[model samples]
Target: MDKKKTLLTLSAVAIGSVIYNYLKPVKSDVEVIQDFDLQKYLGKWYEIARFDFFWEKNLKNVTAEYSMNEDGSVKVKNEGVNITTEKTKTSIGKAKYAGNVNEGALKVSFFGPFYSGYNIVMIDSDYQDALIFGDNLDYIWILSRTKSINEDRKAHYLKYAKDCGYDLSKLKWTVQEG
Candidate 1:
């Protein structure tokens, strides 16, 4: 009986550890922007570059559109073209501020009841460019109001991402269709 009890306790501990790790807020040296203006941020932004991942594999001409939902949540619309298949793909999601609304930290859900962190770490004064980070270091994106960004701005963001421990070699420049 004691042996069975010990096994059960160990199993519970292991499961709990997994859940905690997955649910934990992102711990990183990177900072999240404060005093974020969601109104100005609500619009279409093109993905200038990103870290390649399975979900966005073979995609190009990617763009993310943000709008307000009736229930005070931000609606997210992501669209891209599959270069290999020549098909357009879209994903719709919703985001709510994880912390204060003035902060740029948010929790977004594409799948029902499952949320992930979305942080806007940096933005230009005009709100024309932004640096976005996900729950972990593996997810990062450079976004611009237009389909392409200027060279100087691109270099600045690249440097910042590198300083924050991102792997530049994994960065993929998004193809923008005119």
Candidate 2:
């Protein structure tokens, strides 16, 4: 009886350890890119992949469009197709540089006056695609101008994210209609 009790306690500890590791946020040293050009970054970006979020549930063919507004803030329009419901969903938001313009840090809000972090940690030259990270490691998205991504680029981003301590098992490869 004592042996069985010991075995059960050990098993519980092991399971708890795994869950704790998964839930704990990755303390990243990853900084947003320097010399960030908000104007150049403004354009349509497809959701190549992302971590699941309630607002984006059942979404496919997701895309985010950015453009400059007269007030020097950015206008954001997010669109996605809900194939499950056979309907299109759209949300409009706005963004402004949260820090220095040279830093790839911005605050975006779809709701009135309430904003959230929208930082671009990794982006290639020519702005073809980018990796968007949130204030914490919980939120992440791989965005590209094109709907499809080459394996090479995808591999690079995956490795980088892993190195930054993200759990790759949680990544959801987004589905988009060509």
Candidate 3:
């Protein structure tokens, strides 16, 4: 019985350590964009570049549509087509403007019962392009309304991302075609 208890304790400790490490906060160099104009920021945004993840890998023609909800939250609808499978997936979520509009931060909830932080780190004056950052600073995205971005524009955004302490080399440009 004593041996069993010791084994259980060690197992629990190991599990706890793994969880802590996974949830450990990441240092962010990206500055939250304050004073963002929601009206200008609204509308459809196409994903140009993003960090590759299991759910979104090999996805193309991805876009996010945003509109104001009745409760003053922003409705987020993300859609994409899987190049390999030729299947489409859409995820619906809601985002509430956190604090004042000047903060440029929003709380998004896709899990229905829980909310996550979504901050706008950089945006163009015309709202043509934007760089979005999430909690832990690991999830970053560069978005535009069109399928492609100009060379100069892409370079500019990359530089800004680097300035924000992002691992630019890890960025995966979303393949627009199969």
Candidate 4:
């Protein structure tokens, strides 16, 4: 009887952990950009910089393409080149606005049904540059329409990101060699 009870308790705890992880709310201090226009934002963007992660390790020349799906969801196609092998890698995902369409917060899923936060913290008027944040400080990205961002804009973004509590030291400047 004790063994069965222990097993049940363990299972319950495991399930609860999963639920909490997936449903945790975004940090209160982080704000999503309002007045976002998905139509203008949909296009190819170069990854100017990003926080290093396991999946993108040793990758360079990363680019992301966004397009509207027929069902009103956004289609995300990310491509990167392996620096050592010079081979390209691609991952396709889907995104849906988490709340109001004007808000820049979206739930993105590369793995089906397992959505993660994708918030546009800031975007230029021309949609040529953007700063993105995930649910927490673990994820951050700087993107641009061109391969590189100008020094002034880069400095401004760095300052903004730092002010937002992100550690800029972990940022990996992506190589965009065409």
| Count of backbone collisions in candidate 1 | 0
lDDT (tens digit, per residue) of candidate 3 on 10-77: 78876775685478577564567877888888899889999887667888888999998888789999
In model 2, where do residues sit more than 4 Å from their true spots?
A: 1-29
Q: Note each model's CA RMSD in angstroms.
A: 6.5, 10.8, 6.2, 5.3
**Using TM-score as the measure, what is the rank order of every candidate, best first?**
4, 1, 2, 3
1-178, model 4: which lDDT tens digit per residue? Answer: 6999999987887687588786765553678899999999999999999999877999999999999999999999999999999899999999999999999999999865677789998888999999999877878999999999989889988999999888899999999996
Cα lDDT computed for each candidate against the true fold: 0.88, 0.87, 0.80, 0.90
Q: Judged by lDDT, which candidate is best?
A: 4
Give the Å error, residue 11, model 2: 43
The TM-scores of all predictions, comma-separated, are 0.85, 0.82, 0.81, 0.86
- Model 2, residue 96: distance off in Å is 0.8
How does model 2 score by TM-score?
A: 0.82
lDDT of 1 by residue, 1-178 (tens): 6999999987787677569667764555677898899999999999999988777899999999999999999999999999989999999999999989899898998866667778899889889999998888778899999998889988988898888888789998999999
Which residue pairs overlap in candidate 4's backbone? none
lDDT of 2 by residue, 1-178 (tens): 6999999987887677568556756545578999998889999999999988877888999999999999999999999988688799999999999989999999998866666678898898989899888766778899999998778888998998888877889898889886
Worst ten-residue run, lDDT, model 1?
Answer: 20-29
Q: Best TM-score goes to which candidate?
A: 4
Candidate 4 least-lDDT 10 residues: 20-29
